[model samples]
Target: MMLAIDFVVVAVIFVAAVGAMSCKNLVSSVLLGGLASLVASYLFLRMGAPDVAMTEAAIGAALTTVIFLVATRRTQEVEE
Candidate 1:
């Protein structure tokens, strides 16, 4: 059961990473990156690293995402 859960989380992280890379829109990429970070945090928690998980969630997921979104809003989107 735990192994299955780990596999699922790993899969999600890979998907989110791919999605972020393929995204042309900055906002979408930022959101996907945050999703990946959150998933990584969850995995960290499951692996018995609560400190690392909290750091990842607070800095990687939340703070970084907000920063990216703000930066995205300040810039103009270019159409391809």
Candidate 2:
């Protein structure tokens, strides 16, 4: 049962990764990246590393995503 759940989480992560790479919108891509990180945290928790999972969720998914989004927001797009 756990193995099957792990496989599903892995699949979701893979899909989110690919979606993040291929996305045209910066916000959507960032969101997908966050989703992948969040799912990875769940995987870590399932693998018996609660500390690692919490760190991933707090830093990777939340902090990184917020930073990227804020960076993008502060940028000015120039059309040539």
Estimate, for each residue in 1-80, the C-alpha lDDT of model 2 and write its tens digit: 98999999999999999999999998999999999999999999999999999999999998999999888877844321
Winning candidate number (lDDT): 2
- Choose the strongest candidate by TM-score: 2
The per-model lDDT (C-alpha) reads 0.94, 0.95
Q: List the residue pairs that clash in candidate 1.
A: none
Clashing pairs in 2: none
Query: Candidate 1, residues 6-80: lDDT per residue as tens digits?
Result: 999999999999999999987899999999999999999999999999999999999999988877766654421
TM-score of candidate 2 against the unseen true structure = 0.92
Runs in model 1 deviating more than 4 A are 77-80
Residue 14: error of model 2 in Å? 0.2
